[model samples]
Target: MTQIAQQHANMDETLMLEYGKGNDTAFAELYARHKGPMYRYICRQLGSKQHNKAQELFQEVWVRVIDNRNNYTVEAKFTTWLYRIAHNLLIDEHRKNQVRGEHLTLVSDEQDEGILAFHQGKQEGSVHNDFLQQAIKHCVELLMPQQREAFLLRHEAGFDPSQVCEIVGAKPETVKTRLRYAMSQLRDCLQRKVGATEVGGEREI
Candidate 1:
């Protein structure tokens, strides 16, 4: 690795600790690293109409991160900690507004195509890829908020079921069920486009 690049490759927990010790540079580096994906996640969750509110919540999350640095721990991944704060803030916003939006399932398209590739018997990568993209987009819109959030945490954020339960404050079975229901609904929604993916919808999640 290049000398400067190597220097920039600090582990998330290590950077968190460094920032906790009042190193402004460490905090800046950490912020720069996660800012994009974090902002995208917030925007996706809150949607376009609430962009201003999303920006406000984004700042609020960072403020909490900075203020609570002394109490940060390495027991979980830094991104998980960050997402938990965002998720809780979103929940708070929902409670305060007495609304949770329209329960849309729009997610960022920057995720690995794997999030769109759940076909069991159908091809993984083939000519229908373009068609499947639209199908996935339409299908995702069918998911409820909990289902969509669970799906994003697992697929986009790469959190496993247990970590998802922790970050989402849900039970083990509940998290798994949410994932199953999400995939099932998406699969069912686009079955014709998916072309015999062999996914089952009988399971309750």
Candidate 2:
């Protein structure tokens, strides 16, 4: 990595440490740096059907961060710690849904721009690409919750498998199996939608 980018990447831990020491400005900086991706993560987790609840949960995640500042440690990357909190909150939400007998599914309200950009760069024909996006989203919603979480943490949050294991509190092999199953399901579903080999028309997951 470039020296400048490396320095910026390291700032998250530094900012959180400062915040632990009660530096409000440091806390603000940390929030601003992370809020966008983190909020989107929550929104995608709940899907558009529960956007209002997603907003509440998003705020709660930050509130927990603020509440726990003094207890923060530098043992891991700040993003890892932050996402671990989110993972736990999502688990609570799933349990609540189960108790209420609500069918739980994770669908994106909109196509992820990152995924779209990737397809755009690699494929021609917008119409086919759009269909592919919708197919992928549909298949994702059908993933089992454990598999879906592992998939999103790896793809959406750009976390490596080890970091995903940490966030989800799963063994390395468990997380890997989840990811493998998710990819297989998505690929199989997409192939059924667009015909054989089309899953690779843009790029492999």
Candidate 3:
């Protein structure tokens, strides 16, 4: 592993212990380490609409971590346990909201602006990338709820296929299938939005 990864691996246990001992800085470090992945996972789970809810849920997750710090064990990867907490929070939120639609809005105005800027910068000479990213987001939004959850758990959260299976309570092969289908749908959608010609010459992800 690179230096940063090695450092993280070394500090994971120490951070957890420190946080459990009421060390706020340790908790802050833990948040800094996992926030992006957790936020992305929540964003994917809620589609783009849960932006505000995600923030609320994120804080709740941290609060749970703090409240239950003394109960943590090092048997499993801290992230796996952390994600489990997030996953449960999402389920509760979904139930409370009675969300029945497949299109969960994952992006807020702020995130949309950042995504737009990211694509725009990449496609400096053309609008293809911007169009492609928007199209992909739309296509992703249309995914079946389970498929979206599985795919995001695998990609955004960087979970292994087996880990994704565990998180989503599916078989490993099922998670693989979901990711495959999600990617295929996104590729087709991007190709259509940007046109086949543009897609042929587009930069690889």
Candidate 4:
């Protein structure tokens, strides 16, 4: 195999270790591989409308990753370690908002309030691109935080249930349940929004 192919195939943990040992190239490659999804994951957590805020947080995540390179262990999945940082930073923001008496609207499992209300769009039979995006975002925002976190970590970040457990510090069964609930909620919400029984084509999101 070509050297380029080998580099491309390097595991995240390996790249992290290499970066820890001062291999800037490995760190660059790892960032390239992870940046897109990491940004999206943060957006999904923070809200897509919070674009500038999300960008700021995304930069912070990378900065933390760089500064804490020495703290990473080869035993844990690199993505899990990265996610733990992201999650904690978000929690810190939530706490800050609370302290200022400016709490962000949270998804309540009971009341089912959505971030975006597009009731008329649902009856329209077909939702085009922008509408679809809004619908999915609204659906996501309606989910319980734990459920949404698990879903984004699993689907957006490509982490398995075990890795998700490690990142979230939840039990394996709890992680599985969160993922299941998240998928179920998304599927139902999207189906109602777009008049479809499925989501993400045949992939089920």
Q: In TM-score terms, which candidate is top? A: 2
Q: Report lDDT (CA) for all predictions.
A: 0.73, 0.80, 0.72, 0.76
TM-score of each: 0.68, 0.77, 0.75, 0.74
lDDT of 4 by residue, 1-205 (tens): 4676445445778988899899999999899998999998888877645668889999999999899888878665577788898988888876886797853445453333232234333433455566677678778877777888899889888777888888888999999988888889989987775654233233332
Q: Any runs in candidate 3 off by more than 4 Å, and if so which?
A: 1-7, 99-124, 196-205
- Judged by whole-model lDDT over C-alpha atoms, candidate 3 comes out at 0.72
Residue 96, model 1, lDDT: 67
Clashes of each: 0, 0, 9, 0
Ranking by TM-score: 2, 3, 4, 1
**Model 3 RMSD vs true structure:** 5.9
Residue 191, model 3: Cα distance from true site in angstroms: 2.4
**Alpha-carbon runs more than 4 Å astray in model 2:** 1-9, 106-127, 195-205
Tens digit of per-residue lDDT, candidate 2, span 1-205: 4787568768988998898898999989988988887877776677656789889988999999999898988898888999999989999998999899875673443434444444543454556667687668767776888998899888887788998999999999999999999999999877765653354554553
Report lDDT (Cα) of residue 56, candidate 2: 92
Candidate 3 shows a clash count of: 9
After superposing candidate 4 on the true structure, give the runs of residues whose Cα lies further than 4 Å from its correct spot: 1-10, 101-130, 195-205
